[model samples]
Target chain A: MSLFGRQSKRDLHSLAAPYALDALEPHERARFEKHLRTCDRCTAEVRALSEDAVRLAWSTAAPAPLAMRDRVLAAVRNTPQEASPLGAAPPRPHHLPAHVWGTEPPPPRRRAPRMRPLFAPLATATAAAALVVASLFAVQATRTQDQLDTARAQSREIANILAAPDARATNERDARGRGIGVIASAKEGRAIVTLSGLGDLPSGRVHQLWLMRPDVQPRSLGLFQGDTPLVTSGMNDDATSLAVTVEPNGGSAQPTSQPIAQLALKSVGFGE
Target chain B: MEADELLVRVAGGDQKAFEELYGLVSGPVFGLVRRVVRDPAQSEEVAQEVLLELWRSAGRFDPGRGSALSWILTLAHRRAVDRVRSARAATEREQREGMRAHHPAFDQVAEEVEAGLEREWVRHCLERLTSLQRQSVTLAYYDGYTYREVAEQLSLPLGTVKTRMRDGLTRLRECLGGVA
Candidate 1:
């Protein structure tokens, strides 16, 4: 979805720097981050900028109070380390020059052909160039049209989530980097769920989505593949959370494997 | 010991490594949190929470992904920023803070942290950014203002502020001599 939940990739790319700075509002941050998973260039750029931000933090080196360290370490001694076996994030490529995406590349240099003496030839060449440009633009327009059509189609249900007076978006990621982002309207009893970094599963294994309620069984919202966002209803005023699990193809009546990821749906709202 | 390696060891339940990591990073973590959170009690509280999180979540640190220092500072910064974002009526007063957040606020932060070599280096590089870019980076990073709030404070368009932050940080990295 764009900034208001209609995602335009160009606008989302510009958010990398702000995202690194922790400068975005919650819903916007969730949206950009959901975009970040599939975006390799932005990932590299964020890592590089994050390195710079870390340097900015290095100067504030006031020593911790003597008693504070003991408190923390004591807590640490009692706290068991998480058993999460997720490996480190894959290495990021080198950051590209800043503003590679911000400023448009310099217009391609046009070679000045010397057709000065032949007016007829110049006219012919001009027509051919115009035709080429038109066809190229037509191809681009078609692609944009297809994307717009998809956006419009999904907007019907998603807009219910984004436009709700109490629309709220939340995002959660596992240590493995698979994440889920949801925008839901409490009043409308509707939600839009988006998944990221969950790549294709092996044959016969599919990703399942469930609406976990307090008293009832985790209801199946249906299975998801690829990167499409899902819209589910039946959210009541309760502490509901979304969970995703891997199950055999078709679907499982219940989540078999431990949830690969889960996000609690707390007071979902996007008022800001 | 290398910071990430120590974190990995801590992940493996190495108590010694956890202690060693604390001695190394605790100051920087506390300082960064204090810089943003401002209040001593809350800053210490947030810092303690972040360090404890460092212990419990150490298993998630991937050496291949990034430096341990960067990862920990990120955790600290986010927690600090979130603390302020919720506690303060920032949006209501952000417009008023605009004029005050410019050179004076930037100067105070730069001067406060001037004791370290990296602080001096960062101050020098921050000087290279154009005015808007500098405001965009400093207000968000130091003052714990959201970019939207930064936009309100600086009276710049949101898009403009976002780009300035990216461009400003990019320039800072360049001045600091490119990505390592």
Candidate 2:
């Protein structure tokens, strides 16, 4: 009855049981994984189980309401960009004031502290202090220049995206078109949907998307906001209908009533 | 352009690209948080925080590690878990316990009523497990319950609960064909 020993089927199952739930003690799981490489049967079992767990996880994943999407995207828009950890350092700006720029200069290539006769000690210390000030300015200027260049390049890239042809398409949401806009797109897998011109919802309300197909009832694609777009799954041409509605802030089991605006999508297009 | 490409533009400081990337990742990011956090209001709050974090940190994303989707999901998961854990710590157990009392076990439900792209794969894989194994696995992963907690809830021995969870995951991995 004890399947705690060796490579027998029962023992393997017993060991794999915890691995399935991710409940294994770390050492035990590691040992089982080691044995799994050589044992095809165990490997197969583990794979099957993990997939089941993924399904369970998937079932529970409901789309977050539209307001949340707007909030997050809006946040992303405002968030500052950080320098690449791997990219080359930005060139130092030559014109910036030394005080405003880079790291302080190395302390006048400090000479080792020397014991001097007491009388001239003040003079020696003053000289050393003066030297440090001069070096600090030089180092500060160089670092400041580097930071300036990085900021300048980043700003230019941003300028280009704004100037791009599609920039207007995304930024200005159309009211006449029933608040329709394409936020972002991929050829095969997904796209971001945007809307505007729709009146704002009350505090607890959020917009939602439904992917309508002939074969099934409209599926709750996810939530969105009039101010920002949403990324919904299953956007192919087969996805005949796209509709929006106000649901409870996080969205609902289904569209409670008619959509605020319903648009038919012929095909899922790649982002322009 | 790809959504990730737009995100790269956003990182460069393009407002349009930032807007575009927002459209693409926002749903999953939001949905993921909502699933974990449960409260619509709180979920939205967490979602807003995650998005802002994503925008601020877009420059940090490296395509090498994984897709943009994964990057966003990782952020959402971390934030949601953080929110839940923090709230759990701040509130009494009884209050939080009342909040989670009515949730249904995913396995007991038939198939996902909505046939999304991944639904079939998800259903097939989940169906492969024995009922007990499936239940234990779902409670731990999706519900965010620990194995010991699951054991207590189901009135099963701790070791037995652990075994079922492991076996359940193993079966799922195989059924899904492989991990991403």
Q: Using alpha carbons, what is the TM-score of model 1?
A: 0.54
**Positional deviation of B134 in candidate 1, in angstroms?**
0.8
TM-scores, in order shown? 0.54, 0.42
Report the number of the highest-TM-score candidate: 1
Calculate DockQ per candidate and list them. 0.29, 0.19
Off by over 4 Å in 1: A1-7, A84-272, B90-109, B178-180
Task: Residues B73-112, candidate 2: write the lDDT tens digits.
Answer: 6556545655654554445464566754433333343443
- lDDT score at residue A256, model 2, on the 0-100 scale: 95
- The residue-by-residue lDDT of candidate 2 on A1-272, one tens digit each, is 34545435465556565554444444665577667768878766655554344344444455656434433343332223444332222343443222221112111211111111112112111111121222222333444556546534533332332222222112222346355443322233354455555776889998888877778788887877444335444455456657788888888988897787765454223222
TM-score of chain B of each: 0.86, 0.69
Which digits, one per residue and each the tens of the lDDT, describe model 1 over residues A1-272? 34755456778888999988988887997787777779899889888998888888887788898756655554453334445332222222122111111011112211100111111111111111111122222222334556646544655665344445455444556668687766666677787676766887889998899887778888888787545556678766564788899999999999889988887776353221
